[model samples]
Target: MAITLSERAADHVARFIEKRGKGVGIRLGVKTSGCSGMAYKLEFADEAAPEDIIFECRGVKVLVDPKSLPYMDGTELDFVREGLNEGFKFKNPNVKDECGCGESFNV
Candidate 1:
């Protein structure tokens, strides 16, 4: 199992980290909340945890905890701008369905 970031995502993350002044990478995980039973959690990591599984993509590091791997395997994060709204998008192959609001998903 693995997680990845698109070139656009990597560039966005790298720029944010540089501007923020400190970071080792970005953390990707799932939490048991939201209408679809699961929601994606993202944050900057100043340091990696002992159990984090790390992957490098386009010069940026993507970190994931073991428990989240099954649901997020083969997921690629991308940054996009549609008119004025912009954010990270998850292209997760394991997702079976997502909530109507697109804030959560369930396998």
Candidate 2:
């Protein structure tokens, strides 16, 4: 099982890490809150935890907690732009349903 980042997503993350001057990679996880029961969480990771699973994609590291692996396996993180709107998107194979606001999902 693994999680990955699109080239654009990786590029964006790399730029952020460079700008911040220090970081090991980005961490992806989920939290139990939101209309659909789960919401994606993203943050800069300064280091990997012992229980974290790391995947290298597009020359960037993507970190995931062991507990989140089953739900996030085979997921691809992407960065998208549509006119004035732009942000990270999740392409998750395990998602059965998503909330109207696109902030959460249920498998």
Q: Provide the TM-score for each candidate, comma-separated.
A: 0.97, 0.97
How large an RMSD does model 2 have?
0.7
Query: What is candidate 2's TM-score against the reference?
Result: 0.97
Candidate 2, after superposition: displacement of residue 16 in Å? 0.7
Residue 82 Cα positional deviation in candidate 1, in Å, after optimal superposition? 1.2
Model 2 clash pairs are: none
C-alpha lDDT (0 to 100) for residue 75 of candidate 2: 95
* lDDT per residue as tens, model 1, 1-107: 77889999999999999999999999999999999999999999999999999999889989999999999999999999999999999999999999999999999
lDDT by residue for model 2 (45-96), tens? 9999998888999889899998888889999999999999999999999999
The per-residue C-alpha lDDT of model 1 at residue 36 equals: 93
The lDDT per prediction is 0.95, 0.93
Task: Report the poorest 10 consecutive residues by lDDT, candidate 2.
Answer: 61-70
